[model samples]
Target: MNETQRREQLKKIIEESEPISTGVALRYQGETKRVCVYRIPLDFLVYNKYNGRISSRVKAYERLNHELNSENDEDRELIEKLLWESKVERNRKTMEDLVENGQMRHGIVTADGVIIDGNRRASLLNRAYRERDKHKWSPVDVDKCRYFNAIILPQDAGPRDIQQLETTYQMGEDDKLDYNPIEKYLKVRDLTDVGFDIDEIAKMMNESTADIKKWQRTLVLMDEYLETLGYEDMYPMLDRVEDQFLSLSKGLKDWQDRSVLAKANWEYSDADIDDLKVIAFDYIRYEQEGKEFRRICKPGKEGSIFQDRLIWESFRDTHFETMDAIAEESVDEEIAHAHADIDVVDVLRARDSKWKSEISDSFKNNLKYSVRRLDDRMEDAKPKEILKKVRDLLKEIDTEQDSFLNDEGVATLVSEINRMTYRLKRELGQ
Candidate 1:
């Protein structure tokens, strides 16, 4: 049927059927009755916006009250008031558009009157109704705002169905509000619990299977890892750890082919996994200490040394026991800044006081690595490119020579530059 016919059909059904009874008289307990459009009272509808879409219900009610109490409680002005006062400003434009055009589309609400979609619109309409009795409007249409049009789902639309539907409606569309990673993780988990596989859920939800699998695996790892750290209740913290956890997951997966890391069914063993979890937490702290410290950990790379299997293996082999001790103690301390070096084992092992000073010492290694990389790039460059780079390097060297106060270091760098200059001139025939 066409849009007008469909809306008229739903309205006819509502007109013919009795309004859903509340309390014990309501025959349907869950969302298991029948699909019917209802002209639900604005006051009866419950406001439950999630995933940072709207303000808290209490705040929303207050904002609604504030607008209603105003002298000019016009429909158009109130809509703007709610949109302007919304905690999530992203909803404002959509809400403004709806207000300008009026609600042409219907919202999906539960039999118990909880809005599943079009919350911003519903909330505004409710606000208009609440204000109708209290204030006078220049262009009044309070009767039109007294009730909201909704496709009330069956009472038997259980939690899983509601979650799936809500996610489908809100997050499945390209223009809809993007679910926070943690929120998406929880939704994917719910879908999985309801017997939907990765591919099935992806297709149903209009998401990629790869993303579904990634979220599932990362969520499992996060839950287990948090439980191991005795912080299972801190799941909210996982929101900030998305990048870290994903990188850690990728890092661990890199070990899938290795016999040692693959022992526990292609995953780390119980004990080893615990070790890795603790290490991951510690790595998070070190990462928070800022780039100055990160350079000390991985020298030139952006990620932690723990992410590198070759370097991590040596550190793990040399001080596995110390790592466990540090992990245990660090968790208790809630450490937010730890040593950044893979050789953190050595420092912890020796109880080295000089390690703090080694923060600046790491710059030498970073410089060496940077120079080696430059050498490799220059080797790959054309003669003209090489000549230009050589000239730039000579100027940069002269400018930076005074930066290092260590006479020995400066002299050594100068000697290397002299050699490079001689070799470059010979190669370029300059």
Candidate 2:
């Protein structure tokens, strides 16, 4: 139904039903008011495409398939699928509860039938209505599932007001815990696009303005990452890497202001920062997180590849070379020629996994060697411990001419060790 038709249906329903308070007061027009709860037919309302649980999912879909029109059958099915898949177990439990108890809490919707709150409940209501016949259910439960119990907003409500109300109900309260962390950052972006400032968004989300600002910046980093991997605007691709982005974002922030650094041997420029971000982006794409990921880009600390200039230069050169060696084997060409049945993100993700699996040994080996150099240089490094490790390694090597000469790298290192030992003996006056 169009907006006017939906509004008219809602108005007629509200006029016929008496307002049930249920002791719930909704803040509207700068005042708190107890609104009437009317049973609106489920067909009159559309699931919110920007619903917090599936906002990024929808965005990612629309990014590739164009904007979704919920009025369309296929699009509606897709939206419902996203909602259901957002939290399948929780949705199942909610569906069960809905079948048994009906809608315990009233939802909020615009006069034009856009749900602002209780989307999950309304969705489950729709599900119960459709699936009622598949299972044993009470007659009243089955009948009640056909309609949604909700408070319809007044006609004066604008888009900004609807967005704000959605934020207040869905994100400013307990329900926020169910939301994906990436949702807030994208929500901030959406809210800002709809004419809300940092302070207004902070107030709506119940976060500090500084937090909103930081999320905005972090969101840009996330966007850049998507664009870098040929997945521009596919926010769902980041579903598993929120922590990686958070850590990388904080490191980038620290990179911007080195005054906060505790100790550093490197003086980096903006170009260096870009390199750091891109390198970290690669690791994030490969799903290397936590301290393992930090060894590549953690800021204001020693031992990280970027924390030391010499280590960074060598690591960067080798990393670039390694990436270039496999660049031709990436899934981009495959994605380009892929049959319509294959998912692009899945292919790219497979590419990342394959890439990590292929290069993990070399990647980790280089990083470990660099970090070992850093450890050796630190003021607290134990010389005897380092020597003992060297001695143990030396004792295990085969010094036979055939075995030693067969391995060129071992032969080179052994020669260098012999020269170093001779110098040490002379220095000790042996």
- Residues 1-430 of candidate 2: C-alpha lDDT, one tens digit per residue: 8878898888988787776555568898667987778888899999888888888888877876779987888888888887888889999898888878877888999988989988788888888778877877777878888888888999899988888898898899877988898898888987999999888899889999988988998899999998887778778789899888888888888777875455557678889889888878877877876876776776544546677788788888887777777654543576777678776667666767777887787677777777676666664667678878678878877777676868788868878999998997898899
- In the predicted model 2, the residue pairs found to clash are none
Provide the global lDDT of candidate 2 against the true structure: 0.81
Shift of residue 427 alpha carbon in model 2, Å = 2.7
TM-score against truth, every candidate:
0.51, 0.91
Runs of candidate 1 with Cα error greater than 4 angstroms are 1-38, 48-87, 94-99, 127-146, 225-235, 256-274, 285-310, 313-430
* lDDT by residue for model 1 (311-337), tens: 444434533444333313343233224
Top model number, TM-score: 2
> CA lDDT of 346 in candidate 2?
71
- Model 2 segments beyond 4 Å from truth? 260-262, 300-303, 328-332, 336-343, 392-410
